[model samples]
Target: MHSAIWTAVSLFLIVEGLGPMLLPKVWKRGIITLISSPEKLLRRFGGAFVVAGLVIFYMVNK
Candidate 1:
């Protein structure tokens, strides 16, 4: 379980790096846009991701 968690995190980091690595200008623009977004909108977007992740995890485990 511990190793599995670390592997998942490592994969996530790799994926997170791809945007900046492959398309730095686009990624920077996206980061700037996200920075200007409203706090409430960001919260809702983050919450959606959390819920979706939880659903995916549950389905995979089952």
Candidate 2:
């Protein structure tokens, strides 16, 4: 369980790093846009991502 958790975190970090490492400009623009976005919109996006992640986790485990 611990190893699986660590592997998931490592994969998440790798995926998160790729955009900034490959296309800094695009990544910067996306960050700026996200920063400018309304709080409600950001919350919705966050909620959606969490829900999606939970669903994927269930599917994978099942």
lDDT of 1 at 4: 86
**lDDT string, candidate 2, 1-62, tens digits:** 99999999999999999999999999999999999999999999999999999999999999
Measured on C-alpha atoms, candidate 1 has an lDDT of 0.98
Alpha-carbon TM-score of each model against the true structure: 0.97, 0.98
For model 2 the local lDDT of residue 19 reads 100
Model 1 weakest lDDT span, ten residues long: 52-61
Span of 10 residues, lowest total lDDT, candidate 2: 1-10
| Prediction RMSDs, each to the true structure | 0.5, 0.4
What pairs collide in candidate 1?
A: none
Instruction: Give one digit per residue, the lDDT tens place, for model 1 in 1-62.
Output: 99989999999999999999999999999999999999999999999999999999999999
